[model samples]
Target: MSTPLKTLFDLTGRTALVTGGSRGLGLTMAEALGEFGAKVILTARKQDELDAAVAHLAGLGIEAIAIAADMGKPDEPARVVEAIQAAGQSVDILVNNAGTSWGSKTEEMPLDGWNKLLAVNLTGPFLLAQAVGRAFMLPNCWGRIINIASVEGLLGHHPRMIGTIAYNASKGGLINFTRALAAEWGAQGICVNAIAPGYFPSKLTGYVLDKHGEELRGDTPRGQLGCDDDLKGATLLLASNAGAHITGQTVVVDGGASII
Candidate 1:
């Protein structure tokens, strides 16, 4: 007999680690996994934020915990992996969502800003994935890696409207990283994928939303910005057994914005 559809999406024994999961898109995805029966671990730079997120998840009756670690720091990935190991669990799902952005004109962009964005947005995810995969996934021979890329990664943004060249480049690199890593690890039962989200109301895009909310809405065929729940479904699909055969793919959750 074939497996039931609901059973395929169930993640009862899974553990998920979500970087930058204290707020915004990361938090949204974390909640989805937790709600569907995965134990979730949230990582970010702030202990207070992490505590609050854990409390929120607890209120929702989801098993959750927090680890305060800045993904940009080189030593932090090992620390995060250690924390999980200490808890007597390994990550079955990894979400690379911790990132930072800088807005500046290309010619006038500061070298420091460029480097900082790349470190946090691109390099951080790479290191963390390496640590987790080595310590857990590779050993167990089963894992799911969901990279949080952006629509900006898929297309160039207008310099005058949004000066985030480094951010765009970093996310673009992450998208390809997802594809490359999937190819390398698929034979070992590790599925790697990416989610490229469009505009959503978060601290990361507060300034842009304040200035161009209407303009962006007009640009999107949906005539609206994404809500908190917009990313939940796509994330669940990729994180569960439902996506067993899906790997090396980027599911764009932009309400048809990228289509145009």
Candidate 2:
């Protein structure tokens, strides 16, 4: 008889692609996946950063590789997929963690800025999924797609200081896309889900945290910014066997902030 612990959450033979895997939230989720025994391929624009993150994962006894590609580019996703396929590896999991945000008054935001945000935050994931999903997932009859979204997708940002209309819209669209993909692919044994984080000390929030760390923490029910470990369980639960039956769900990792 197999133990619950043995069968649940086991990712021993899985392969993953984590875009924006060089730092912050991306790296955190990549590390968690590695810890659960998945071979992780990290991709980002900066080769130096990807190299560093690959080295760090190696130190943890995880087999990781760095692929330097700008997922934001229109053609780069196919190139990155080709690189992975050339290595004779099939993607079993994809963490669409590459994203960007620009903050400015909606009226002041340039059209280019809006388009850029959608390219990285929304289009990139869709293209990557379409490429990888068709090549590997649909053929093998199994896969996982985890998009890293944000709480701002669920609710509007503070009117007094909120400035990123494009970011908010992209995230909202991402959530809906996750649900739609999950619904369509469930029969094919592919699970598509999202994780909406809140107030993490990532590069995107460094400026805000630097300026108002104390004030922000005070407002949060948890009284502290989200830590790296905070993302591990949820991600693993969604990516591994533990979540085989769960699909198209957005698992919010915020510390009760949305509840309050």
* 213-247: candidate 2 lDDT, tens digit per residue: 88767778888879989988988988988888889
How many backbone overlaps does candidate 1 show? 0
Prediction 1 TM-score vs. true: 0.98
The candidate maximizing TM-score is: 1
Weakest lDDT window of 10 consecutive positions for candidate 2: 1-10
Local distance difference test, candidate 1? 0.93
* Cα TM-score per model: 0.98, 0.97
lDDT of 2: 0.91
The TM-score measured for candidate 2 stands at 0.97
Tell me the whole-model lDDT of each prediction, alpha carbons only.
0.93, 0.91
Which window of 10 residues has the lowest lDDT sum in candidate 1? Answer: 156-165
**Backbone collision count in every prediction?**
0, 0
Any runs in candidate 1 off by more than 4 Å, and if so which? none
Question: Candidate 2, which segments miss by more than 4 Å at Cα?
Answer: 1-3
